[model samples]
Target: MAFELSPLDRELSNKTINENGFSVYVSGKIKIDRSIKDIRHPRCKGKLHSSNLTTASVIISFFEEHWETLLRTVASVLNRAPSGLIKEIILVDDGSSRKYLKDELDNHLATAYPSGIVRVIHLEQRGGLIRAKTAGAREATGEVLIFLDSHCEAGINWLPPLLDPIAANYKTVVCPFIDIIDANTFEYRAQDEGARGAFDWELYYKRLPRLPEDRYHPDEPFDSPVMAGGLFAISAKWFWELGGYDPGLVIWGGEQYELSFKIWMCGGRMIDAPCSRIDHIYRKNSTNFPKAEFGDFVGRNYK
Candidate 1:
């Protein structure tokens, strides 16, 4: 007798039945998010866990003009990453103009790093960061995937902190404390030295040093309902399981908010780890890509 597929499974199968050659099968009674145990570190049996948490892949999505900065960012990662970590670095070129990044970019990266782990995926047409990130995520092979912008600089011990929470079977999204650097002079500033990151209804981002007097503390691990997507890490399985970044968003704006909300409301948690810190270039005028139509996207996401 042929097994009958439930409505949710049928929907998921349909969604993945296209040219991608991958299928997403969802079950109605089984909650995909809760089915898996909490994220945890691997055992030291000298054997790889089926969960695949030993190594990590970093995704850096960049546009045309920021190629040089992207190179520098990758160099920083290579310089600071602890030994025997980082399985690979996936660089997604979201339609760049520089001949170096397209034709000779990979060669240059190979020459610079010489580790043979860096891979580049060039989009023939510009898909913006949202699409670029999705493309990179799809290609990522590591068990844990960390997403960072092209202009950010990695801090010492940055890689492990992002993966530690996930390794511990927390099943929660994790982000590090992000510091800002002046775009012109590269002067670094710690925007949130004492506190973790937070968000507000205004959609503005900030760091909260202390919990409010009336707020409830359950005595569990540190948890935040929302986190800045500028630098966040998650297991590759959970990422795709959460449906990845909403393809509905255009360019770069509401993607982070969507991930933050979905993780919390869908019965997962988001945390800000004070132990990890990354520096990002803050600019008065962004020269990377064209101004995105983020207002309409935000409205659609919120509504």
Candidate 2:
């Protein structure tokens, strides 16, 4: 499957924010490689295996995302992920208002993923990430449901490792080793495979180094206290049965912990698989997200 965006796409993809919230960058049309290979941990290479039984539908929720970033996200999945294992790619538009995002995106996907592998779902009104992901999950047909951020790029052979444990036990919810993609330069970088997501009482997440026990088996999946939330995979049956994501939670804050605690309290376990890795663009929420528009929704979670 080949992808070539039109001149209009290249122009829109070159869009950058250098104002108050973001770092300074030039406006003279920058070029980024769409087919950059991701760096993976050497330990994750030959030790992993996949099953033909447990297939997945990857759900990517987006609001008013950069035209190029969103396209690259989907392309990464197409380029790295196994076509047969990936039943469908669901792109959820949370009522975006950008002119370039509307018809142009629809037409782009129509050509890029013409094999009916990609499905674009447009919401009539804004529902934030929670609702957008929920909407995407509702439309998923695969046995396992995978969720990724709009700016994420999965590494080579990233899918099988995440699904292997799920195939063994469907109730397990798994997250890949999330690496940081430089927000400004679009450079793909690797992270310590032992690092996992953690947060404090205030619900702010940060990467914490793994303890001695975590490195006991570098190739094995380590149990995690919490997930980064933007990327993870859960069984379709368990997700709906576990009530999906909290419908009451708004925007993006506090949702990760909510799901984390939900999984633990309900006898389900969350694991961070070292074998599966993905790169996500490290963009600041203050500039790239829609949380500010729905700020008061944060109060709803506490109430």
Candidate 3:
């Protein structure tokens, strides 16, 4: 759904866009538990999952994320997912400078979710996304570890599809069909049918047209050459076996390719679950954020 802003809201939205690279004003107007239309294929509606699926610990890493968007990401998971399947939700704060993110966020989670299902880990020093996620995984106790961006909304019945395949084959790594949330208007919409994850010679992330056989089975999980990096689920056991992200790789650049190659070479496989849909906020002005100086890290990691 898209929101219509007033003249004053537009001015505020523009300010947020300049600051956060997205419309924080519009995101603030959205309900924490806002309902998004189910855009999955018809076949996905009747699919059945194992009754004894393994539990998952969701880890979200943030630096200076917008308040409402982060809260909505939490709310969407709590509201839409089955409670029994979620072991915990861990918020990894990668040295955020925002005052509200410190004590205010902790207090809100404590009061809002008195069950203590949600918790926060504030890094005293800035650990890049790779290390932040690794820290979260080390602290996670669930059988599976699911990594998500700080500003994403979980789609209806998203967990079961992702878990079902992994439950059957613990060596499998699963990625969801990522939909786009408009950076300016806050409109929720589908990206497309689907495509295979791939990369060109330069090692930049790219998508290949789905094979003819994959097009014939739109609702089933299909093999993907690489992951888009932000959203994916891996068995806790398999993740550790693969040694998580390379400790030497700083910040985020070629980690997706690194993991994708590890999955294929180490007697494991990566699959894209069509039934699992996740909406991600693609920011407009990413250059506004201060860049961490990790010179030649992408080239070094890719090597």
Best by TM-score, which number?
Answer: 3
Over 53-83, each residue of candidate 2 has an lDDT whose tens digit, in order, gives 5889999999877776677788778778766
Query: lDDT score, residue 144, model 2?
Result: 97
lDDT of each: 0.66, 0.77, 0.90
Q: For model 3, what is the error of residue 271's alpha carbon versus the real structure, in angstroms, after optimal superposition?
A: 0.4
Worst 10 residues of 3 by lDDT: 287-296
- How many steric overlaps does candidate 3 have? 0
Candidate 1 vs candidate 3: which has greater lDDT? 3
The 10-residue segment of model 2 with minimum total lDDT is 19-28
Give the per-residue lDDT of model 1 (tens digit) for 92-136: 998877787876888887787686788899999787788999999
- Residue pairs with clashing backbones, model 3: none
| Prediction 3 global C-alpha lDDT | 0.90
Error of 3 at 195 (Å): 0.8
Candidate 1: lDDT of 27?
Answer: 18
In the range 116-231, model 3's lDDT, one tens digit per residue, is 88999999977688999999999999999999999899888999988998899999999999999999888889999889998988888888889999899999899998999999
Of 1 and 3, the candidate ahead on TM-score is: 3
lDDT of 3 at 210: 91
User: Number of clashes in every candidate structure?
Assistant: 10, 0, 0
